[model samples]
Target: MKSRRAILAELFLTAASLMALFPLAWMVSVSLMPPHDAVGFPPPLWPSHPTLANYRELFAHQNMGRYVLNSLIVASLATVLSLAFNVAAGYAFAKLRFAGRDRIFRGLLAALIIPGQLSMLPLFFLMKELGLLNSYGGVVVPFMASLFGIFLVRQYALGLPDEMLQAARVDGASEVQIFLKIVLPNLRPIMVTLGVFTFLSAWNDFLWPLIVLSHDQLYTLPLAVASLSREHVQDSAMVMAGAVVTTAPVLVLFLALQRHYVRGLLAGSVKG
Candidate 1:
């Protein structure tokens, strides 16, 4: 009976996986289909005649490559800057002795309760004042530190043996040296998870980029895809191709880092 139940569970899981992934598969299939094939009768699941025309058009005319590059730059910058800032802040909160540190952290957590949309107008005004609007700095600056990222890191770091930091201090190690040599190595799982989260969030960001970036050249993949959709509404296959392009990088990144992400989540939750 146990063996039978195990097989049944496996079967159920397999079906659920297929159900979740079917749309992605369909999107790729449609992208490969010839023009008008994606929107054809019965909504064909597979391409009758596969062609690279949609992808070719995107690269050749739509300036998709430039958009992809823009996204890469934005995402990479956001991830690196956020990682550095959040790790330091989190470690400070977890280990350092400072007045009102807990109060300040609680204030940050309270800020998270406020809807982000409510602040956009003020944020935009602030950006304009700083002369960062319509620039890469505009997009990258706002995401460089997130409360959730800091919280995640703090939670993970809290479980790290305090003795290590004390020993490093006793040995006359500086704060920077301790963080680099001891804390960072121990926080590997959380770092990978946070890095992946930041990268994907920045890569997939559309609303902020659209609001901040006015020039066509600064358009990210999601913005470019939206433009493509409006301009080529009838070209379903082309739109699908754009979706694939916008989604593929993050998908690959997540899959590659899936183990680290899961490990980080488990460690952060269970350790502390």
Candidate 2:
């Protein structure tokens, strides 16, 4: 009876998992279906006949390729720049002695409690004043560093051996050299984890890019996909294709680095 119950439970869990993933599966199935086949009176769970016509249409006429490139460049740049800024500030907060460091960090932590949206109106105006509006810099500048990123790095760095830093100091190594040579190598795992987090966040960001980038030419994938959805409401297959293109890279990145990502989450939660 116990064995039978266990088997039943497993089946139930598997069904639940499938249910959760059904939308994604359906999206892919429909995207591969013939353009008109997806929107029948009763939607088909599986494609009757699969075709690449929707994908071809997305790239050929919709200029989705440019949007993909925009997302890639913006996401990559944001990740790299955020990593540099946060890692440096985090390491300083963790290892270096300075006046008011703890107080400043506490202030930042408090600031994190406020929603990012609260700053958007002011931030947009600031970008406009700097002539960064409608440019990549406008989207990338505000996100170059983050309070959460700094906090995460500081937590990880706090656990690192201080003796290694002292050894580097004793050797007359400058702060920058010690950070580059001694600290950065040891930070590889956290860096990978942080980079993934930053990349995903930036890539998936919709509202800021939508507000800042008025030019269709500068639209990232999410923005472009949204625009396509509005313009091509009848083209369910094509819109799903766009969503697949927009979501696939980040999904792949997450699946590949999920272990590190989970570890970082745990470390941050426990340490903070």
Candidate 3:
């Protein structure tokens, strides 16, 4: 039988979980309500008559389908690029011997303390100079690599057996061959975690896309949802539906891959 303290702890955790989930549940509930049913002085906890009209209207009139496609393209590209760049850099940092390698990594760690917002001006100017503004490339460029990604992969890669890599080299396997054949397979867990992270970040990103993408057709789901809010300010139900649409994909992806993500994160943390 469970101890009283354990039961209390379980009850407390359940309550906390409910509290955390309440807002998301309410958002879903309000999305199914009638057009203006959620705008009252006392907001509703449940829809009186559930309906799919809000979702239909969003896809029909707001060009939400295009926005979802745009988001998918950007997020998928960003995930691929992030894996390509970060995994290589991280493995190099963890296993390779090179002059200034430690110094460079230390500098990167130091730079993490600096706020990302401060770099927007320079990044914007650079994007403009490259003529990538208002393009898909502009949206995907910033996510090609990230400091946290490198850090996480580096930590996980540090746990890889060095003897195997040395043996492969002794057998005349080139560095590229070893990395492709050996390192990549071993790095799957962290790769999944990083891919999920990059996809979600790129999918939900609004500020950078907002700044770089000026045309309405180039808008991502978050940006489209924000625009929809302005255009339908009084249609709370429709806006909630847009929010649900914007959130659903990433939420599902995370839920599906949560085990791998948690395992990778925990392994990286302990190894680091």
Candidate 4:
């Protein structure tokens, strides 16, 4: 009876998992259907005749490739820059002796509770003043350094031995050498985790990019998809194709790096 019940429970969970993934499966199905077939009264589970016309139309006519490139550029730049800044600051807070370090770090932690939206208006004005509005620089600037990234790095860095740093110093290794050679290599797993997090956040960011970037040519995938959905409400297949394109890369990245990401999250939570 116990074995039977366990088997039944596993079957039930499998059904639930399929149900959760059904929307995505359906979207892909619909995206391959011929233009008008997606919204039929009795929806088709699979396209009778799968077609890549939607994807072709997206790239050729709508110039979705540009949007993809924009998303890639902004997200990658933000990830790289944020990692550099956060790791340095976090290591300093974790190991370096300095006056008021704890107090300042605490203040930063407190500030993290403040919603990013509260700064949007002022941030926009600041970007405009610096002539960064409607440019990639504007989209990438606000995310160059993040509080969460710093916190994550600091938590990870705190586990390192102080004796290692002292030894490095005794060997005449400068602080920069110590950080670049010794510390950064040890921090790789967390860095990969942070990079994935930062990339996803920047890629999916809609509101800030929407507010700052006015040019269609500069539209990121999320922005372009939203705009496309508005204008092409009738084209369900095409819209789903756009969504697939927008979501696929990030989904792939997550699936590949999820172990490291989860490890980093657990490490930060336990330590912090």
- For all candidates in order, the CA lDDT equals 0.87, 0.89, 0.90, 0.89
Every model's Cα RMSD, please?
Answer: 2.5, 1.7, 2.1, 1.9
- Candidate 2 has a TM-score of 0.95
Minimal lDDT window, size 10, model 4: 263-272
Clashing pairs in 1: none
**Lowest lDDT 10-mer window, candidate 1?**
263-272
Q: Tens-digit lDDT track for model 2 on 45-76?
A: 88889999999999999998999999999999
lDDT of 3 by residue, 152-242 (tens): 8998899999999999999999999999999999999899999988898899988899999999998999998898888877788888899
Error of 4 at 186 (Å): 0.7
- Let me know the TM-score candidate 4 reaches against the reference structure: 0.94
Colliding residue pairs in candidate 4: none
Ranking by TM-score: 2, 4, 3, 1
Candidate 4, position 119, lDDT: 90
**Residue 211 error, candidate 1, Å:** 1.2
